[model samples]
Target: MQNYKKDFPIFKNNPSLIFLDSTSSTQKPEYVIEWICDYLSQSYSNIHRGLYDIAINSEKMYFDSKQKVADFLGTHDLKEIIYTYNSNYALNIISQTLRLNKVLKTGDKVLVSIVEHHSNIVPWLILKEEIGIELEFVRVTQDFDIDFDDFEKKYDEKVKVIAFTHVSNVTGKIFDVERIGKLKRPDTLFIIDASQSFPHMKLDVPKMNCDFLFFTAHKVMADSWLGVIWGKRELLEKYKPIFSGWWAINEVKKECFKPGALPFKFEPGTPNISGALSLLKALEYIEKIGWYETVESIEKELIEYSLEQFRSRPYLQLIGNTESKKRVWVFWFYIQGVHALDIADAMAENNICIRAGHHCTEPFMNYLKLSSSARMSLYIYNSKDDIDAFFKILDTNFNPTWLTK
Candidate 1:
């Protein structure tokens, strides 16, 4: 695994550094950076603009990267994939598509869990206000898993869609997509925010039984600010792009213009050629390293070991279930005599960076009765020693002021 660490240039000189905030973003690998540089330097040209050699070659590279993403996601139809600025943009696109198709309306309701990131929850709120649809929330257990019995009770015909995170960014709880998939109705669409899970865990949308899904490329060690949205062909076909640009149309006729079909209809402007190229290289990097095996080893060695260290600590409270199978490495916890922000700052002083805040799940924080918590999320580059050093810092610090606050 240490040999694999060599591929990530960010970890090379920063051997003493600890990075545990992969939920926010991840460090890029050397190959992805090189791939982007090569594209911008050598193959730089606008795609689908001209038949000239460079333009044609650039178009090939851009579309080829899309095909690579499709393959990585295990989709049969390349047209089913749509590129967006980020996961948030992708979710907005879906919400717009749903509105345009009238799949969302005054009487319709959209179901989401209480633990959703803002990317998943905010869009639904906007839709509810704009289109007059109702928003419904599923409950979570004390240990942070979905209350399935409550979810089943909330299931009904008025619910037009159900969207949830595959894994919580703060609690690191992994949702059983299979269970949610089983609740699909004819009119109900199932969407999964795979931002945290797709990068680390093995993913198969068809197997997960989702109707629409999106995840960012950079989170998975791919290109920055690029993401992929996967949707069933039929549902997307019914949507007219809300922000349609000239590029989204098939042709500008002598009289007027007409929109392209399916995926092309959603891509509304000049594409990110360099980012797409880098994403391809990142997917290739994951393939070479073996995605499944990497995830498995990290869970066993780092995630489980870290949990074992604090599981029995009286002054510390783990926010989610420690069972490796039910969680990812994106875990959060609190110490009795510590402010989350202070702990994070102390860790940063030692060159260890973790995240501390509501983590964009303010509603969940309210539910937990916690103002904030410190999160130590893991990626492939993190080692057991990193976890060891972080815990050592926690043990060495005890601030009485934290408890009084």
Candidate 2:
């Protein structure tokens, strides 16, 4: 397997650190970090507000970053991409805008799944309370996959919106978004949260048939506090932005105002210029490594190796599909009679970093009858050696008798 750890400086600084929580956030690459520093030091200015050389350059770089995001999502329309704080902010904007636009009225239904993160679920719940809309959830099968039968049965003309995650943050199971997107009615809107999938796979927005998709930059090795929301041109034009400011408007009177065009309308303030530039550099880093040809293969091999090690340790019970091919490298597991916090603290003491919590999916945890679980999510920098070391720690530290006792 390729050793991509050299690209990230964190591993070099902490020689014994074994980071296995990339699903939550990835460590920054040297390339992205340097670019951010250089851009801020050399050409830092507010964009679209000035015509000076540095200002023009900064504005160009910001839009260029947006264009790069558009290209990454396989969309030709740059105007369709809007910048926000994160996926959570993006979802809130969509829900509020749809409600304000009358696209979602009282008694309308929104279909989501039990596998969604709190970011996707809470917005709809709030909308339900505010607008009297009905919120429904599609169940998960025993294998930790979405129940398509339940989805189809619950979906009908009254279901005005369908929102789901492309990959479950806890299970790493990739949903069949194309199938669900294609199955929806013409008038129904489809929204996808690609926080876990965008960094690992190539997604074609037009081909997915979804009206809107959103993801955060931090998960893809970029800076945090930046996100992208890509929507269909017509849909974006139809919905008025819930938030407005000086840059987001064309004209304003004391009583009313006209919102600006596609992206600017939704983006209402001094944006995260450095965050966007960092995302551009992160995408470039992915391209440099040949994401589809190299990174994906490396992650697959790591998943297989990790699963093999997991199987040998019978005390560890995985929460999702046992097959590596069916999921990403994220694994959530538990030991009988051992608390998740105890396992995570033990791993931390051994210089291994893994996450332990409900993983922002309390509903899914409730569905599985689990209070919490320990998660180890792999990324490009992880290797078989790391997995072996992890298992070695487990073998030396945890035993069935101690766990049961």
Candidate 3:
């Protein structure tokens, strides 16, 4: 019931805007924006190479942010974290580096679930095409939850790697990562895509037992173009740099060069300095606002309220788990005989933003026999009023007559 929208400037500017698409990207808070602007205007400089006052300060801030990221993820080792362009680039780094270093070879198997985003699937598919590695997809149940029986059956000694998402972007089902982590073979590496879950939950890398994990900053109220990759030191040191340049080199002769240390070897060239600062501020803001106690409680309340509202409307067919406690704030549903795009356009006309598409999981969509669905993802800034407004639009604008047609 608390009003958290005042922290976001977008709501003040667009009074009628009801944003329900935080899963795609979250709106920036005033705290993060002001910090980014102040840093850029007063002390902006390229990091790691300059020796002047501003340069030294900038380099310190950059590395301090990396350290903050490591601490936030429950890890103390700074060398384990690598900043990249985004989650897509991070996954590609892992795949390509493993392939080039011969860590992943032909005839090996990689296991993934059917409810993964393209970012997690495409790199492995390309690897399958390039090498002789086999790609297998675990099935999902009718309710959109992971079929753990099938997963256990498919997982074997041949599977050298297991890559999966912590939460499904389309279905909002929280995967049992701890269970899977315990089931993994000692020699097989486990990777996690936390882009969807990081914003809504508390994540500890050691507790999850993943060899590698990555997520984007934009989804957590930070600026875009920054992603974080955390891996075990030993595994990261085993693979050579997939892309090497000025900052990632240790020593350079005329013909060959040695790669630098853990993170620098992976993060080549000039990185996103301002964006990294923004992430530091964003994490600070979340902590200051009591992320676990306050932000998570608000999201849970919104989810329960939204599900209660959905129960009153028989026309709206909800997808995924119906129980509120089993999922996050993402919800996907459709009205029978109504095209998803048309529903989205109708909501847009009412100044309510929602997404209707495959949501980058075309294979899962194909499996469900659904081309598209309307998705409403909430965040800390949302409230029960937003849910009421969304249902109001559906009730008054879309009637039984229209639904039947």
TM-score on alpha carbons, each prediction: 0.94, 0.97, 0.97
Per-residue lDDT over 1-405 for candidate 1, one digit per residue giving the tens place of the 0 to 100 score: 443567787888787677878889988889888777877787688887888988998888777777877776677677898888899999998997888878788879999999999889889899888988888889999888999998988888899899999998888888998789987877789999999888877777778788998999889787777888988887778777777776789888788778887667888888776777777788788878776676667666777788887785566777887676678887788877568999899999999999998999998898778987888887878887888888878777743344356
Quick one: best lDDT, which candidate?
Answer: 2
Off by over 4 Å in 3: 401-405
Question: Model 1: residues >4 Å from true position, as ranges?
Answer: 1-3, 253-256, 399-405
Q: What are the runs in model 2 whose C-alpha is more than 4 Å off?
A: 401-405
Provide C-alpha RMSD values for all models, in order: 2.5, 1.5, 1.5
Comparing 2 and 3 on lDDT, the stronger one: 2
Clashing residue pairs for model 2 = none
- Candidates in order have lDDT scores of 0.82, 0.90, 0.89
Query: In candidate 2, what are the lDDT values of residues 255-342, reduced to their tens digit?
Result: 9998998779998889999999999899999999886668789878888888888887788998887898668889999988878898
TM-score of model 1 vs. true structure: 0.94
**TM-score between model 2 and native:** 0.97
lDDT of the structure predicted as candidate 1? 0.82
Evaluated against the true structure, the overall lDDT of model 3 is 0.89
lDDT of 1 at 344: 92
Error of 1 at 364 (Å): 0.7
Model 3 lDDT tens row, 1-405: 774799999999999999999999999999999888888889899988998999999888888888888988888788899999889998998999889988789999999999999999999999999998998999988776778899989998789899999999988988989888898878899999999988878888898899999999999899999999999999888888788988898999999999998778888889999998898889888888986668778977888899898887888998887888668888899988888898899899999999999999998888888977899989888988899899888887676955477
